[model samples]
Target: MPEGHTIHRLAQDYAEAFAGTEVRVTSPQGKFSDAADLLTGGRLTRTDAHGKHLFLGFGPAGHPTPAESIPARPAAPGRAAPGPATAPAPAAQDHDDPDHDDTAPSGWVHIHLGLFGKVAFGPVPAPPPADTVRLRLVNDTAHVDLRGPTTCALITAPEKRAVHDRLGPDPLREDADPGAAHRRISRSRTTVAALLMDQKVIAGVGNVYRAEVLFRHGIDPYRPGRDITPAEWDALWSDLVDLMREGVRANRIDTVRPEHTPEAMGRPPRVDDHGGEVYVYRRAHLPCLLCGTPVRTAGLAARNLFWCPTCQQR
Candidate 1:
C-alpha cells in the first residue's frame, strides 16, 4: 500500500497541476462514472489529504479559498486537510483551510487507494487509459488517471468530515497533534508495533514505517504501548515528522541515517521490491548496520516485523 508520504505527494502534485482549473472528470472503466459526472467541468478548488485518504474539492476555478481571496490575510491556502484526529484551525487565525470553497455543491471526492491503487499523471490530452482505470481528471495542460483504488466516490461535506473524524492525526500536516496520538497509545495494551499500524492511533503509519521507525528508535516491536515512556513516544513521533517529510520531498521512503547510507557504509544499495534503502526491514538474518547481530523477522499483526536483536533488545 502507498504510505502517507506518497499520498501527501499526490495531494501536492494534483493541487499544483489541476487545482484552479476546470477539469474533464471521467471514469474510463465506468466504475466511477457517477462520481466523475459530479466533478466534470468543475474547477478543482483544492486537493486535501488525511492519512491514507485523498479528497478533491470542486468549485469555480479562481474563487479564492477564503485565504487566497483576501489580501489582508497574508497566508498560503494550500495545505493538507485535517483528518479525524485533527481539527482545522480557526479561519480567523490562518487562511490554510483545506479548499473549503463556498461554491458548487458537488463538494469533495474522497479517494482511498488501499494496496494496489495507483494514479498516473501526464501532459494534456491524456493517452488511452488502462482497463482497470477507475477515475481520470484532465485539465488543459495536464491529466491524472486513477486505477485499482479501494475507493472512488463523490462525497458531501458532512461525509468528508465524518471520514476525517475516524482517523488519527497525520504528521505531514501542519495541524497534526502528536499529543492525541500519544494519549491513544498510552491507553492501549497492544504491542507498539500493532498500534503503530492502527489508523485511529496515528494516521499514515504502515508496515514499512512501523518496522523502520521502531528500528530507528531502537524500540522492541513487541513492547506494549502501555509500557512505553512518554519521552520515548515523543522521540518516535518527532523522528516520523522528520523522516516522513523527507519521504514527501524526495517522493520515496529512505529511512537510513546519513552515516548508514550505501555510500557512507561502502556497500551496495538495498535490493527490494519497495525501491528504497532500509535498515532492518526485510534484512532478516542479515548483519545489522550498527552491530554484527543478525536481523530477525516474525509475523506480527499479519505483517512482517523486522529488527536487530542486539540494537532493539528492549
Candidate 2:
C-alpha cells in the first residue's frame, strides 16, 4: 500500500490537475454509476488527504455560495469494501461560515486506494474505459482513472471531518502534533514497531517507514512503546518528519545517509519493487551499510520488519 507521503502527493496532483474545474465524472465499472451521475457536472473545489484516505470537495455549476446539496447514502458495510460514514447536514441557522451558508449540502468524494488500487492520468479525450477502471474524471485538458480502491464514494462534509478525527496526526501534515503520538506511545504496551503502524497512533506510517525509522534511531523494533524514553520518542518523531518529507520530495523511500548510499560505497544502486535504496528494510542477510553486520528480519504486525542486529541492538 502507498504510505502517507504517496497519498499527500496524490492530493497535490489532483488539486493541480482537476480542482476548481468542472469535470465529467463516470463509473466505468458501474459500481459508482449513481455517484458519477450526481457529480457529473460538478466542480471540485479542493482535494485533501488524511493518512491513507483522500477527499475531494465539490460544488454545483459555477459553485454558487450556499448551494444546498445532499450527501450520498453509504453502501452496505458487508459489501465488497468498507467506506466512510455520512455527517448530518449542518443546521439551517448555522451562520458560522459567512462566505457561504455552512448548512448548504455539498458532496465530498472520499477515496482510499487500497494495496492494489492505482490512479492514472492522461490527456483529454480519454481512451475508452479499460475493463478494470472503476471511476474516471475528464475535463477539457486531462482525465484521471481509478481502479481497485478500497473506498470510492461521495460523502457529507461532516463525514469527512469524522474520518479525520478518527485518524492520528500525520507526520507530513503541517499541523500534525507529535505530542499526541508521544502520549499514546507512552501509554501503550504494544511494541513500538506495532505502534508506529497503527493509524490511530500516527497516521500515514507503513511497514517501510516503520522499519527504517526504528533502525535509524538504533531502537529495537521489539521494544514496548511505554519503555521507549521520551527523548527517544522525540528523536523517532523528528526523524519520521524528515524521512517522510524526503519521500514526498523524491517520490521514493531512500533512508541511507550520504556516506552509506550505494554510490558512495561503490555498490550498485539497490533495486526493489518499493523503489529507492533502503538501509535494513528488505536487506535481510545483506551486510549492514554501517557495521558490516548481517541485516535481519522478523514478523511484526503481520509484516516483515528488517533491521541490523548490531546497529539496532539497543
Candidate 3:
C-alpha cells in the first residue's frame, strides 16, 4: 500500500492541477464507465483524502447544487448525452476565480495508488500501457492516468460525508487533534505497531512512521499501546507531527538525521524495496545510526517490522 505520505502528495498534486475546472473523465479500460460518466465534464471543486482512500467529487458545476434542483439542459441540440445526467444540473460556470484561473482540473482526479498503483505527470505522449490504465483525466496542457488503483469512485457530497464519518483524524489535516490521538492510543491493548497502522486511531501513519516514531521515543514496538506511558505517548505524537510535516514539504520521507551522513552512517542500508524508498524499513542487521547496535526485524501483524534492538530496548 502506498503510505500516507504518498497519498498526501497525490492529493496536493491533484488539488493544484485540477480543482475548479472542467475535466474530461474517462475509464480507458471501460471498467469504470458508469463512475466516469458521473464525473465527465464536471468541475472538480475539491480533492480530499482519508487514510488509504481518495475521494474525488464531480457534478454539473458550482459546488454541487442539490441533486434535485440542477437544471439539466437539453443535450447540445443533436449531440447525444454521453451518460445519465442525474438530477438538476447547474449552468456552465465560467472559470474566473482571480486566485487561480490558468490551472486546470487536471490533478483533482482522486487516486488511491494502492500497493502497485502509481501516477506520473508530464507532457509525455504515451503512458506506461493501456492494460495498466484505470482512469484518465485530461485538460488543455496536462494528462493524468490513474493506474492500478485498488479503489476509484465518483463521490457526491453525501458519499463524502459518509467517508469522513468513519475515518480517524488525519495527522496532516490542519484540524488534527493530537489529544484525541493520544486518547485512542492510550486505550488500545494492541501492539504499538498495530495501533500505529489503525486508521480509526490516527490517519496517514504507516509502517515506516510506526518504526521511526517508536525508535525516536525509544519505545518497543512489541509493547501494547496501553502499556505506553502518557509522557511517551506525548513525545510520539509530537515527533510524528514534525516528521509527517517534513515529509509533506519535501515529498519524501527522511527518517535519519542529517548529522548521520549516509557515508558516516556506513553502508547504504539494505531495504525491501517493496516499491518504496526506505531507511530502517528493511535495513535489518544493519548498524543503527545513533548506536552501533545492529538493526533487527520480525513479522508483526503480517507486516515486516524493523527496529534497532539496542536503541529501542524494552
Candidate 4:
C-alpha cells in the first residue's frame, strides 16, 4: 500500500494536470459508469488527499452529488480522503476544508488505492484503457488512469467530512494538531509501533515510517505509547512532518540524516525496490548504519517491523 506522501503527491499531480479544466471522466471497467456519467464534462475544481485516500473535487461549485444525480454506494466506513498534511503554521487553517471555496465540494470522487491499486499519468492521446481502470480523467494536455483501487466512488461533501472525521490528524497538513495525535498516543497502552500504524492514532504513517521514524529517534518499537513522554512525542511528530513532507517533494521516502547518506558513509546508494535510503525499514539482518550491529525484523501491526537492537534499545 502507498504511504501518505504518495497520495499527497498524486493530489498535487492531479491538480496540476487537470484542475479548472473540463475533464472527461470515465470508468472503462464499468464499475464506476453511473457516477462517471454524472461527472463527465465537469470541471475538476480541486484535488485533495488525507492519509491514503484521494479526492477529486468536481465543480462549478454546485454540481449535484452522485447520491442526488444517480444511485451510489453508501460511503465506506472509516474511508479517508487524500491531501497533503500541510506543514505546521497558523495561516493554514483552511487548507483541507471542503468548504474552502465558500461552498461544499459540489461533487467528489473518493479513491483509496489499497495494496494492488496503481495510478499512472501521461500526456494527451491516451491509449485504450486496460478494461481494469476504475477511473480515467482526461483534458487537453494530460490524462491519468486509476486501476484496481479499493475505492472509486462518487461522494458528497458531508460524506467527505465523515471520512476525515474518522481519521487521525496527518502530520503533512499544516492544519494538523500534533496535540490531537499526542493525546491519543499518550493515553494508549498499545505499543508505540502499533499505535503509529493505527490510522486513527496518527494518519499517513505506514510500516516503513513506523520503523524508520522510531529508529531515527532511538525509540524502542516495543515501548508502550503511554510511556512515550510529551517531549518524545513532540520530537516524533516534528520528525514525521519533515520526513513525510520531503517524501512528498522527492516522490520517495528517504529518511536518512545528512551524516548518514550513502556518500557520507562511503557506501553505495540503497538498491531496494522501495526506492529510498531508509535506515531500517527492510534491512532485516543487515548491519545497522550507526552501530554496525545486525538489524532486526519482526511482525508487528500486520507488517514487517525493522530496527537496530543496539541503537534503538529501550
RMSD of each: 5.7, 9.4, 11.4, 7.7
Candidates' TM-scores? 0.88, 0.87, 0.78, 0.88
Against the true structure, candidate 1 reaches a TM-score of 0.88
Report the Cα lDDT for candidate 4. 0.80
Q: Which predicted model would earn the best TM-score?
A: 4
Tens-digit lDDT string for candidate 4 (1-314): 99998887787778768766788989999999999999888887666777888888887624433221111111223543232323211211233355564433567899999999999999989998989999999999999999999999998877888888898998876568889988998888999999999999788899988899999999999999999999999999999988887787678899999999999999999998999998998898999999999999999867889999999976
Number of clashing pairs per prediction, in order: 1, 1, 8, 12
Q: Which ten residues in a row have the lowest lDDT in candidate 3?
A: 86-95
Off by over 4 Å in 3: 61-111, 124-129, 263-279
* Model 2 C-alpha RMSD to native: 9.4
Between candidates 1 and 4, the one scoring higher on TM-score is: 4
What ordering of candidates by TM-score runs from best to worst? 4, 1, 2, 3
Q: After superposition, how far is residue 28 of candidate 3 from its true place, in Å?
A: 0.8
On residues 25-88, what C-alpha lDDT tens digit does candidate 1 reach at each position? 8998998898787678888765677889887777644654433321111122364433222222
Superposed Cα RMSD, model 1: 5.7
